[model samples]
Target: RKMKGMENLYTLHQEMGNILLSHVLIVRENSKLEKAMTQINDLEVRFKDVQCLDTSHWSNPAPSMIQQLHCQIQLAKIITQGALVRNEFRGAHYKPEFDLNQPKDFDPHEHVDFLEKQHYGEVQENEFPPGHLAYMKRFEECNKRWLNTTIAEYKNHRPEISFEAVNTSLVQPRPRKYD
Candidate 1:
């Protein structure tokens, strides 16, 4: 109870282990992802039992730790889902199922409608910034297909992802080449 301290939370984090590291992570097949996600998801369910032990809101660290853990779970899900959906091998996003030189991942005008419809950028200037879109922000190759941006809305404990348009009316996107 109150004497539990943060050992339980620390143990939970340790349980996640290396699955939390997204960078330099290489997984060829979906089954690997399936297993990792299953563990993380199961961790989420088990997290409910995580003994905060210290419920003292004043100068208490348990609440913050729990909040961070919750956010981590959500982010893990986002990364997994994005990796699952994208069928191409563009930039750092790689799926062994697709060729190294596959087609571009995004459509330049993909999210224009969603952006305009939502009248975005009105959120707290701090949290999401008025001009920034929200829910989830992903970093993919910025090519013509990605002229705007993509968004993911986590609704009803699930993520409903969509794209938002970028105001590229002034300048045009050209072929991006490093050679």
Candidate 2:
């Protein structure tokens, strides 16, 4: 998929990734996540217009890297947007806004439009409204709701993620009192 005017992908990818990386941590109540989402969305728009140097001639990797970068940009948005929707924290996904008591279920379809907007270069009518914003669970809670399969699938070009409880027939869920 070599396209003209794509020469800038390699360099562009590096720069965009660096900028997006800073905002990926910490799940604050609202504004913090809002700010990060804005950053990534802006980058998504800019990335679509990037031009690659056409590797078909020199067989350079710039074209391939550029393509990969484009996909990565969308992925960054997906991750950030997903984090924003889930109010609570589970396992490594923690936001100060929520604790173990508030473990929220992860919704797969929530961030689809954020990913969809990258194509239109503008917020489409069907896109999820902005400012609309997990689950927080203690270690003990993990054995029950979690400890199963975490699923991620792309449906209609959007991520559809769900969880499947682990078959505990062999090992029953229990509280670990390890000191």
Candidate 3:
């Protein structure tokens, strides 16, 4: 089972992956995300070259790779679109423009006790950095509004985005700290 354009499809997939890495990385912004989406779309269009002459999965794995490529492209689109809609920084999806700066002297290890107390209602407001209270207020608001499971479905050659309420009944969501 030989495919005529397996090599071309492999190249396109490689290019798509590189584009995704360079643009939709850990730190993201509007323009780069859009660029990544555009490039991914371009690569998807190029996927037409993948002439699956042999559809059978007997012996040859080219068909399997092509199927995987299709899935990878769709997933990339979903991730890019999801990141674009999310305006606030949460977890690894950080957007520098919409985030606050940490205190210059802040060290997570040094403030472990304080950070623990903040979650337990033992820390005072005055103990926080000057502008941290405002940032935290904004973060809490964002959490209340945007904290949901992003469900993406691929249809009509594009991804349809939806959200579902996250189940937090058993264990409550706690504030996360990376710094």
Candidate 4:
């Protein structure tokens, strides 16, 4: 087998790596997300165009590499779509558009106990840093709306997306503090 599409596969891998680094890293926005999604669509088309050479009775690694490339394309589609839908700055996925400003007088030590507690404990607005109470309210609202597992399935030659509730029975989910 000549392994016809290896060149295309290598190019695709490089392009995809660049796209992910530019669009899905520390800062993301709708435009970047949309561009990434569009690139993934193009990748799908290019992937389908790859002619699979017959490997019956052949002893070579080309077939294995091609299969790995297919899996990589599928994973790229799922991840890009998932990141496109999420509208929050959480963990490693930071979106500048959705980022909230830190409270001017925030004291991490004063609120560490409540922040670590399950269910967030009772809040005393007066005790909070100037803007911290407002920040917590908005954070809670987002947590209620968007805290879940993103589920993607490969069907009909595309990724069908869904969401499932996260299992936080043992330890209630708490917002990650970077500062």
Candidate 5:
């Protein structure tokens, strides 16, 4: 049963990754990166609720787990924000000023060029500030660990039967008699 759960977790993790990538592409394609940023900010605000534990288990999910997940989401938002900031022009994120579908003078290419010029003569040690790099690395490491754990659990628990497809089939199957 535990192994089945882990397998389910793995499948879920893969599906989620694909969905996230699609979202990123859509945002970039539509030049709605700023909109996504705003939404993420709103989510961050809502995340405050996770911190407030109700101590009730029957109605509420595990507070500690919820809090940890919330933290992971926040970390992802932070990393995304950093990437957006680093890539001045809209890269994976959309900016109203630059439309990705159409050719714009200020594209990601231009932004990369600018960044390259800005760091051309900088020493390797000074490329990224120590404090900022440390924080980013820490967030990245934690997020990776969270994702790995989630995938492991999903793979272990997912149902083998295609529940949705089976439910929608033209021929209804007889209900099973449980022992």
Candidate 6:
């Protein structure tokens, strides 16, 4: 039984490699590999036999599960073909194929800017809520400290001047300044 299990595992790995190589080839020759990729994705979703909360005997399968199974079957048929396929590094699977050490063009202020924009959108023009401004100011002041504090440090000594506490204060009619 153990030997059979090992053989099955080995076979699965070989099949996976073959499928990947075939996908790479199809992608190289025909630019329209989206359909093929979609099918492969579908097959993967169905092949996964995990009994999640929605799929358990106690609970019925969701409507989406049927659609997922349909996609898996369609993709499996195309991937099993033995045709000579081209190989090229492209798409999500080829992440490690590119330069690993290159730093991402990250803007730390992007999230803050987005939050501010979202807040602005929610409020009417020239109708700046005093509470909103207070909250924003408090956020800006604590933002640096919040970023610097590690999860371990936070768990050990819960920060008195925390975002949650500050937000709760702001929601009230008269906000109290944290000591």
Best by TM-score: 4
Q: In candidate 1, what are the lDDT values of residues 138-171, reduced to their tens digit?
A: 2223343444345667888755656677775686
Of the pair 2 and 4, which is ahead by lDDT? 4
Scanning candidate 3 in windows of ten residues, the lowest lDDT window is: 106-115
13-107 per-residue lDDT for model 5 (tens digits): 34334434644552343333455455555554544443333455477654555545555555445444433443222223334443222222212
lDDT of 4: 0.72
Q: Scored by CA lDDT, what does every candidate get?
A: 0.56, 0.56, 0.75, 0.72, 0.37, 0.36
State the number of backbone clashes in model 2: 20
Give me candidate 1's TM-score against the actual structure. 0.56
Q: Give per-residue CA lDDT, model 3, range 54-121, as digits (tens).
A: 55657877677888998898899999998888877676687888775554555444355454676797
What lDDT does candidate 3 reach at residue 151?
88
Checking candidate 1 for backbone clashes, the offending pairs are 108-145, 111-164, 111-165, 112-165, 121-130, 148-166
Better of 4 and 6 by TM-score: 4
- State how far residue 114 of model 6 sits from its true place (Å): 2.2
The lowest-lDDT stretch of 10 consecutive residues in candidate 1 is 131-140
lDDT of 2 by residue, 13-108 (tens): 676667555666654455666786777667667776677665456657766776687678767766766666555545455666544432133233
Better of 1 and 4 by lDDT: 4
Question: Model 6: per-residue lDDT, tens digit, 62-157?
Answer: 324544544434444443321112121222222222212211332334334535665678533333433444444444443433322111112322
Instruction: Write down the TM-score of every candidate.
Output: 0.56, 0.54, 0.75, 0.79, 0.30, 0.20
Tell me how far the alpha carbon of residue 164 in candidate 2 is from the true structure, in angstroms, after superposition.
Answer: 2.9
Q: Per-residue CA lDDT of candidate 4, range 1-179, in tens?
A: 35555346667768888888888676778788899889977886787656445556668565676788878878888887788888886657767788766565655454455465424666677766578777766666677767788899889977888888877668755556565
Query: Evaluated with lDDT, which candidate comes out highest?
Result: 3
For residue 143, model 3's alpha carbon misses the true position, in angstroms, by 0.4
